[model samples]
Target: MRLTRCSGRSCLSWLSTIALTLLAGSTLTAGIALDLQDPNSIKAAASTCAYNLLTFYTGNNTGDVPGNLPAPYYWWEAGAMFGILIDYYYYTNDSQYNDLVTQGMLWQVGPDDDYMTPNQTKTEGNDDQGFWGMAAMSAAEQKYPDPPSGKPQWLALAQAVFNDQASRWDNQYCNGGLRWQIFTFNTGYDYKNSISNGCFFNLGARLALYTGNDTYAQWAEKTFNWTQAVSLMDQNYHFYDGAHTTLNCSDINRVQWTYNAGVFLLGASVMYNYVKCSNVEESDTRTDSLLSQTNGSALWLERVEGILNASSIFFATNPPNVMYEVACEPPNTCDTDNYSFKAYLARWLVASIKYAPFIQTTVMPWVQASATAAALQCSGGTNGQMCGMKWTQGSTWDGTQGVGQQMGALSVIQANLIDQVSVPVTNKTGGTSQGNAGAGGGGGVSTSDPALSQNAITQGSRAGAGVLTCLVLISVIGCSWWMIA
Candidate 1:
């Protein structure tokens, strides 16, 4: 999606074609051919992602949580991986990524990352523990067994990740809940963000379902109950900003982040399928009120749907030719100053939109490409536009920005998978909000903080790094019906 605008033509030639084919007053196509997947784009995005994940091993992973982007941190990247794999399948359903997942599963030892290691402390502060673990677990256990060879190695990785996260449940928070992390980005370094904790809980729920383990599911129930009581957002949503970060509770604001919010929904939807009465653990009678057998927590799913609904703003208001935004309704343009957030939000949002089509359906060619172009405009290379991100005013082209932009590459292709499914996820919604969302020019003003009023990132540094050029791993396996466990 972000790789090739002309398939093989040079960027200048391609840009010329764009100009000739599109005019300012010319209405953009409302519906794209659902078969919009591009093999070159898929390969490019997957390859770049491998490098981005590799950065997590070093101290280079950006944003606030420094050393916790890749392995040895968490599995919140399940959606991230889904973004990549969906692109792979859509473009050319290659089984090679599954091979990588299998290889990743085989290497699920401490040396591989932090698979065998326990949390340095009893709290869930172990960043990569659940993030990568969940992605690898889901791919290996459920997804990778498509060829029908019972994957013992993948099963073991899933089991191992479950064990490690479970060990962290000494479980005392500001209230009676599982303490996920004792750290914060804005202020002091000891608080848990709901995004991370929700990811952790969701991972646990996924593992329980994978192994058919009552203990794991029981634990998942407890965490969800705690989340409902504490992190429930806007009275109607299930997401939370943080457990309780600031005095005014303004810090833990709306459940706005797209990838972050998807964790909760994926967990609930996946967990809802398997949460039958099990005598796994009876330590406390406090049941996970959201997981029921006969009927799902209507409110819980509705909240999840509502959260996805907020994400559609990416499509509604933003220029159909632009990429994604960091916040759905950011106070100002600076909120999207971070390049990677712009990239991954679109990727993750697309993953949720497509996978949970009940939440969002329909394929808008112009909308999808707008996001890819905005991101490519940021990246700006033969692959994309090869531009850098606008992360703070002075700091330019850091590792964090690169990490985030790769997410866009991931989403551009992921959405291509379900593009053929013509029905809109919800007929009640339209892409009206995306009209003014992702405008060009880095950012001229700051809606949240005047301090974020940095100018836009220039197009010169749209330097595509070495990894962006080629991702060679690919084994085309026919897409068959699900080989359910």
Candidate 2:
């Protein structure tokens, strides 16, 4: 049974709805759904959602996919939508969306390749660029076919974004971390946010593994350590929102977000695998020595496991083991930026399993149950296929449909497939086995520093490092069932 955290009117209304549906003898299986073990079924669901995204969100220009909020279009959500499409491409190995990815990303980068454009104003936040940068990195990781003819290589574009992000790093605040915004007047400019730092950390980890470069690895470790040092992430492995540099970086925000944890979780897994798979003994040089040190230390890997277990416990629910935001759920309090929170959580849960093979038994139940509920909520909207913002409320749509909603739903569906088919084949870089599109081109600046590398070591693991056995609850969400794989 689904347990909600809301009370009074909202809770009563939701309960009445659930009661009415049960009285009608109606189960949640109305539209198409997938079995978690069947790759074909997962692909079919993802393909339908992929088409739904293009149908509802695509504008006159492919790059003009609008955000749910005002400003008509925002780079961050658009970048997130792009990431969803990239997920579809990777999971299904379908090339149809390749052109869409190419056109959408290329149109946003200006002549300088810094992602600054007249259509885009006040959009220079490191996190904003990091969102699109992560998508570009995904494309690069998948080796999405190069843009037709004269376009920049996919990996090069990602590097340009990363170069710009690295330039935003400020040591003046909290020892070291990227500021939330580049412009002084923008809200949260002086305040660092988890998503900003998490995105940068994730990008650094991915680029390090992708390029086999020590410099990016150093940057990733540095970002991870800074967050830890500033108390942005606590002893319990719970990630807080951010801290204010203006207050001498005191006064922690203490707000935790699902996406923030999700990004860093995935990044940590990448770092773990990077250490695990690298040839640390290849040479006795400084880089090799550093890699060897990181590899021998299980600290990062253990932290990844801790965060996964903590997330499963803190974000718990019972509609067949569904995971909720805890903070935003039971009340439907999620705003525009929060709409896609659960998708990020689901994406990385599956990624951690696929890449590092670290604690699938702990993370898989959440993915399975959440994916089931997410699919059940998709059959009630106008098109008979739109997904809602809250998956825990019930099987009814919340009358919301946009890039955020579609993306949130589509990613959960895509990630669920990984558990069904098998772990995706990944290279030494801990990415899916795909050819590189090409190397990055412009905005190239080395992030390498001897002092930075020397100071990059992470703290040792703390308590609660024991493995968590996966929780399995076999119940019906729809007309589907599965054995834990």
**lDDT per residue as tens, model 2, 165-241:** 66667877677787888778778788887889999899878766665555566778878888888888888888998
- Per-residue lDDT, model 1, residue 324, is 39
Quote each prediction's TM-score: 0.56, 0.80
lDDT of each: 0.40, 0.65
Model 2 ranges with Cα > 4 A deviation = 1-27, 60-73, 281-283, 287-289, 294-297, 419-450, 453-485
Cα RMSD of all models vs. native, in order, equals 16.8, 8.4
Q: Could you give candidate 1's per-residue lDDT for residues 1-485 as a string of tens digits? A: 35564544466556543532242222123211122345344345444544443333332223332223354333333334443443444434555555444444333334423344332223334334555455544444323343234333433444455544444443334443433453333233345556556656676665444443334555566666666666544554545556443332234555455455556666654453333222223232334323323344343345556565544544432233343344532444433323334444443444443233344433244334543343333333343323343211111222233444445444453444444422111101111111111111212112222221121112121111110101111111111112111
Which residue runs does candidate 1 get wrong by more than 4 Å?
A: 1-91, 95-108, 111-124, 145-152, 180-189, 244-255, 272-293, 297-300, 313-316, 320-323, 327-356, 362-401, 419-485
